[model samples]
Target: MDNLQRIDYLLHTNALDEMGKNELISILLDEYGSKIVRLAYIYVKDQGKAEDIAQEVFLKCYEKLDQYRQEASIETWLSKIAINICRDYLRSGWFKYFARGVIDTFPYLKHKETPELKLIEQMENEKLMQAVFSLPQKYREVIILHYYMEYSTKQIGDLLAIKSVSVRSRLARAREKLQKKLETGEGS
Candidate 1:
C-alpha cells in the first residue's frame, strides 16, 4: 500500500492509542505538509496564512479521525478540509480588510544548468503564476488542483463538493482563460 493508503488502513483497522495516532498524524504531516501549505497558498496567496490553514487542516484531521467514512482517500479528505478552511478564511472580514496579493514564495521549478536559462525560466514561471492567480477563484482552484496537484476530475469534484462534469467544464474554461491571459500578457 502507498503511504496514505497505509495510513488510512492503520487509522481504521488498528485501535491506535493517543501516541500512535499522534505518530500517524506526524507521518501525514511529513508526507503532505508542504503540499497542504502550497494548496492553501494557491488560495490565500499568503505564505503565513497558508501555513496557518495547513495547521488547521491537520488539527481538524486529528479531531475528526473517527468520522472519516473511507469512501475517499485520506489525502482527499484532508484536501476537502483544507479547502473548506481556505474558503472560510476567504470569507472572513479579517482577510478582506488585510488581504494583499503576495508573490508566491515557493520555488516550484527545477534549477537549470545555465544562469541565463534559469533566469529566463524564473521570469516565465512568475508570469505564468501571476496569470493563474489572476483567474477567478473557481477557475484558479480548478487549474491548481487539476494541473498542480494532479487530482482527477472525480476526485476534484469530491473535494470541491461538485460534480465531475462541473470540474471538467471548469478545467476547460480555466485553460482557455489561461491561454488568453498568457498570450496577451494580461497579468504581467
Candidate 2:
C-alpha cells in the first residue's frame, strides 16, 4: 500500500504500541514537516514561528489521529491544522507586539550563471512576496494556497471550508491587488 494508505490502516487498527505510534508520527513528520512549515510561514511570516506551528500541527495530528476521516489527503489535513495554528498566532497580542519588530524573509538559495542575474531574481522574488504579504488575510491565503502550494481552487475551497467560486473570486482580487502593488512598488 502507499504511505498514505498505510497511515490510514495503522491509524484505524488500534494495534500500535508506543514505539509503533512514534514511528508513525516520525514518518508523518518526515513526509510533511517542510510543507507544514512553509504553509505556516506564509501566514505568520517568520521561520521560527512557522517551525513551532509545524510542531503543534504534528502534536495535534498525533492527539487526534483517531478522528481523521480520510476524506482528504494527509497533507491537506496537516495543512489545515498548520493554518489554524498560524491564524491563532497571527491573532495573538504577543505576535502583534513582538512580530512587528522582526523582519525575517525566507532564505532562498540558488545558483545562477551570473551574480547580477541572481540579485535581480532575488529582488523580484522579494518584491512579489512583499506584495503578497500586504494583501488582506483572505486574499493572501487564497493566493498562497492556489499559487504557492499549487492547490486547485476546489482543494483550496475544501481546505478553507469555502466555495470554489469564492476561492476564484479571492484569487482574482488578490492578483489584481498584487499587480497594482507591484507596479506601484507599494509595500516594499
Tens digit of lDDT per residue, candidate 2, span 1-188? 76667777777788877777787788898878888877886686556667889999999988887687879887888888888888888889987875554433313322213433344356458688778878999999998898878899988988899999999999999999999999999968
TM-score of each: 0.81, 0.82
> In TM-score terms, which candidate is top?
2
- TM-score of predicted structure 1: 0.81
Instruction: Report each candidate's C-alpha RMSD, comma-separated, in the order given.
Output: 5.6, 5.2
Q: How far is candidate 1 from the true structure (C-alpha RMSD, Å)?
A: 5.6
Candidate 2 structure, TM-score to reference = 0.82
The reply for model 2, stretches above 4 Å from the true place, is 12-20, 102-124
Whole-model lDDT, model 1? 0.82
> Model 1, stretches more than 4 Å misplaced?
1-6, 101-124
Q: Pick out the ten consecutive residues of candidate 2 with the lowest summed lDDT.
A: 103-112
